[model samples]
Target: MELDFPKRKIIHVDMDAFYASVEQYDNPDLKGKPIAVGGGSKRGVVSAASYEARKFGVRSAMAGYIAKKNCPDLIFVRPRFDRYKEVSNQVRDIFFEYTDLVEPLSLDEAYLDVTQNKKGNPSATLIAKEIRKKILDKTGLTASAGISINKFIAKVASDYNKPNGQKTVNPEEVIPFLEALDIRKFYGVGKVTAEKMYKLGIFTGLDLKKKPLEFLDQHFGKSGSYYYHVVRGIHTSEVKPHRIPKSVGAERTFSENLSSEVFMLEKLDSIAGELERRLQKSKIAGKTITLKIKYSDFTLQTRSKTIPYFISNKELILETAKELLYQSELQDSVRLLGISLANLNTEKKKAAEKESVSVQLKIEF
Candidate 1:
């Protein structure tokens, strides 16, 4: 049985240094200086860093004090989420001008399918340039784009030229491009996965392609098959216009660790309240309530319970979290507490049956 693969023109547009750039654009004093957004307090974690700060090893998720140590003059600014959302909406509006097949990955990035765009332009590369320019013109900030046959490659290509640039992997160049790519550069392969691939002597796309399907499956389980397909440039996931969320959650990291249950209960109640507000905003409910605890030593723990009925109230969320908290004795002083709801009441699609594609259709660039 022979099957044909659909050819798609996908573009991934990512805002360059979004939070830090926004800060810089809003305040003239911070432009071209090493700056980080968020992570100013002793316990705060850096959310984003400008390219200037990145030069000194200041990175997102790093401890605030450590970022300060790396770049002594680094200015840390508080994040204005409302302002960022306003800018994000403006950029999203530009994308809608070209196609309604836009899938937002975050406030700063999205995937667009412009195979038959409104502009009637056949060139995806040109469309990417137009989108980036419009974003800059409207927001006074720059964006980078990648145009290719699918989302994965487009996402990978978008990072080739940082700050403000674009890369287009033509249809004919997809396979060779994948073959020459460094295994670590693959979008889904993180640090741990790359190290594992190195141990297996799969250092490049060609090395990955050399392994048989069974050998890959034996070692990587389900992911092995994904590696096998992606290395050959055969991604089929569509650009969804409305991506459904899997869960709703909220968390807080305390400035000081709490040892007593009395102190922790107050924190739990507040955390549950935040979680309830998030669920309410989304107009969703769930049956599974999870409690997350992060100890002062940095070790993490989670406990969950699945009730028969859905719930979206603070009282029920707090009650469940408290039960999970006392289920076991405290191992050490806790520095963070969180509440999350999963198994949401949303229209989740069932997994599609896999089919074999034997025919490789020619795609014109």
Candidate 2:
């Protein structure tokens, strides 16, 4: 069966060792050293690590003690979330200058739909290169980018080169590229899934492509359908722009519910910070702020206020959330405290204008 859709130009940009790189970029002394960002305490975990640390078998999510053991000279630094968020916003603004079809996956990565771009540059590869240069110039950091015709391929291609690099998989190269990739490198195929594929003799993309669709479905269930299309170099996911958020809220179920206002406020402050960070990353401001409270007895109540102008300030979010917490009638020990930002600014122009000239050329032909 032939699938019909417009040929697109997609690019994925990923910052290299985002948090750790930021630290090194700011402190010249830290350059080329094995560095890990996170807790230095015994119970702390590594949130990000530099390439130097990765060389010594240290990685993120590993305990600080273990990471230290892995690299005797490893340097551990505490996470400065606020600073990281600031850098993330700067990188995103750079993306907007190229094309508006930017879909951020996290503070460190995003996808751009550059089928139609502001500069009218015909080569997506050149655009990717320009973006990398701009990022280095603005943030003093490095990023890797992948350019392809779809999200799946773009995402995979971005990782082909690391630290500071760019890779492209033109349409004609897609089939051979997919066929040669190891099964484990396929998106969404983790350790457990790879083991299952190994048992089924699916060791490469070519092996995966040969499997009957029904057989894949029987083994992998719903996700099997996705694997079927991916192996054939087909992906239809759009580069969804960051726009009006459907829901703006944060929630945390405590390890133990307590009546202490101090503890509740501390949790609320963290949640409020996250909301502000997300808002800034999305380049959106919200007018409505909602506070959600869940009692130990499982009852829930929400209070919200709509402001005249959109707000993305961290202080405002925290202050409004605290006020809502105080306004609610506390009938029982609180088990969950949540905050959300809603009713976001949606008037910003979408990225990537339609190709009027290209359409005209097609009509004339």
lDDT by residue for model 1 over 1-365, one digit each (tens)?
33334478899999999999999999999999999998677788899999999999999988898899999999999999999999999999999999999999999999999989999998898999999999989999999999988899999999988879999988667778889999999999998899999999999999999999999999989998899988988788889999987888999899899997789999999989998888899899999999999887778899999999999999999999999999999889998899999999985777788644433345433
lDDT of 2 at 319: 88
Indicate the worst ten consecutive residues by lDDT in candidate 2: 356-365
Clashing pairs in model 1, backbone N/Cα/C closer than 3 A: none
Candidate 2 residue 250 C-alpha distance from true site, Å: 5.5
Give stretches of model 1 more than 4 Å off: 1-4, 213-221, 260-262, 297-299, 303-310, 313-316, 326-332, 354-365
Q: How close to the true structure is residue 337 of candidate 2, measured as C-alpha lDDT?
A: 85
Cα misplacement distance, residue 65 of candidate 1 (Å): 0.3
The residue-by-residue lDDT of candidate 2 on 271-338, one tens digit each, is 88888787787787888899988776667788898889889888998888888878856888987888
For model 2 the local lDDT of residue 20 reads 97
How big is the RMSD of model 1?
2.9
